[model samples]
Target: MSYLSQITSPTLLIDEKICRANIKRMSDKAARHDMKLVPHWKTAQSHIIGDWAKEYGIKEVTASSIKMAEYLCGQGWDNIHIAFPFNTLEIPKLNELAKTQSLSVQVINPVTAQKLVDGLTEKVGFFIEIDAGYGRTGVHVSDFGLIEEILLTAKKSDKLYFKGFYLHAGHSYYMPDIPALYEQTRDALGMLKAKYQSEYPELVTRTGDTPGCAVMEDFGDIDEMGPGNFVFFDLMQANLGGCEKSEIAVALAVPVVDINRDRGEILVHGGGVHLAKDVLVDENGNKNFGEIVYLNEYGWTIPDHEDRSYLKSISQEHGIVKASKSLLNSVQIGDLLGVLPVHSCMTADCMGAYLSLDGKWIDHAEGCH
Candidate 1:
């Protein structure tokens, strides 16, 4: 039987060829700009894929949580940076990992830096997370006093050493125009570098958003890139011009459960639980859960505009596909349909693992219940 027939329910299919290509493309871009490509492992979260990255000369990596850091460290990753804000509760775990690996964590305030200084028993690197208009985390770029306070606290500690600055321009994801997004990202990084470069010439400035890292040709004065989503580009990244449709490496393979000719919809056994609830709004203001495609020997083929279909809505276990009459008639019950996810990161997290086209099961960190 084909790989599609072997999958009984909602399954994530990873195309190894395309995935490796995406990794090389981003790695090359970082090299061209003379920046370190510390690709975030939170997207793939698999030791197998991590090895693939090492083949491209990637020595350092970034992760979102302490658990993920510990998992990757066990896989022999020596240089790991926990990109999330430093958690005081995980200080013991951080210290333990520091004894074995070159561990690093982000600190946003002086109090957090001081806590790490007091609690850490082993030496570890620290990055001052800067809020580059994302407002999600990190200290504001204009707040030099706060940044200095954190740096001072780290400087006073023998175990905690201030490394550099890190920022994620998440707003770039919403900007579909590549030029506009590139300018916004370049200006943000340039502004930060100009204000701090002279004082701390050795400190590195790191940027970690997929859209900027993928689409922008210039990285200004940023010294490192930490993009994670480029490992598996999704429909959302394609829509935002970060990548082409053919570059998407992973898709949800769902078995068709029902066909509705009257309503021109096809129901599948996959839903929000498998693909996550992330949605992309089109130019017509219609919400799309994902884009539809047909599986083939190599991978899958995205239909043309007129023949295109979309996942209109999804419940816990059911996904509604909106397509044309001819497209709806192309498949019957039990057929496996492919869905290009809106957000590959969230979708990969939901699935917790991947099944390659060659019939190998790739394991990852388990999803949260």
Candidate 2:
């Protein structure tokens, strides 16, 4: 039977060869840069996925939250970095985890730094979350007063040691000019490292943005890198010119429940609940939920430009695809179609499980398995 025969519903299909190749590419880049590769686990949140990372010399990994870290601990990952801003409210859980594991968290300010100083019971490390133009979290790179205070407070407790700055450079996701953003982020992190290296000699500069790390050639003064989504490059990354569509490792297999021949739209039993609401604006400036692909005995393939198809919109449990005439006439009510998600990280998080093209069921942290 074909691999599609194993997928009954909206399931994330991982092409192991493609996925492993993606991991090797990033890990090789990290090695070429002579920087530590702490691959982020937020994209493929499964122990089986992480085990594949091990073949590429990845010993330390990055998690988006403390709960993810806790989940990872059971999977044999002792050295984990909680890349999210440290929440003082989870001190008890953090302490419990730290008792037997080496943990680090992102500290955004002096108040939280001081709170961690007073609350943490076990030895842990921290990275000062620097905004670096992402405009989402962390103190701005030029905010020396806040930076100095956070470092000063963190010094009060021997339990917390500084691990230098962490930058996401998330703007690379939407910015038209990626090289310019990478240059700006490199300069920002370099300046911070220069300012603090005198006092904090052991502090290591780390960055975790997929676009910046994936396309940029020169990583100046970056000690370690942790990009999660590059392992499963999605359409968003391809649209940003970071990776080609062929490199994308994951695709959602959804069963077609209806087909509208007049509207050239195919309704699939997959939507926000299965693929998440992340969209990529297509060449025609329409909100595209995902790029459409036709499934085969091997896996799936994108159609030619003349017969291109994609998801126009999605609801909680339905995806409306703006299908090409060829695709519209080709698919039946019960056929399976593949969708390369706009954002693999969000889609992977939504699906919570992976059915490998090899017919193996993999377990996600919160998957149906």
Best by TM-score: 2
> Candidate 1's error at 282, in angstroms?
2.1
| Collision count of model 2 | 0
Q: Write the per-residue lDDT of candidate 1 for residues 223-252, one digit (tens) a residue.
A: 899999999999888888889989999999
Q: All candidates' TM-scores?
A: 0.95, 0.96
Per-candidate local distance difference test: 0.86, 0.88
RMSD (CA, angstroms), candidate 2:
1.8
What clash count goes with each model? 0, 0
Error of 2 at 122 (Å): 0.7
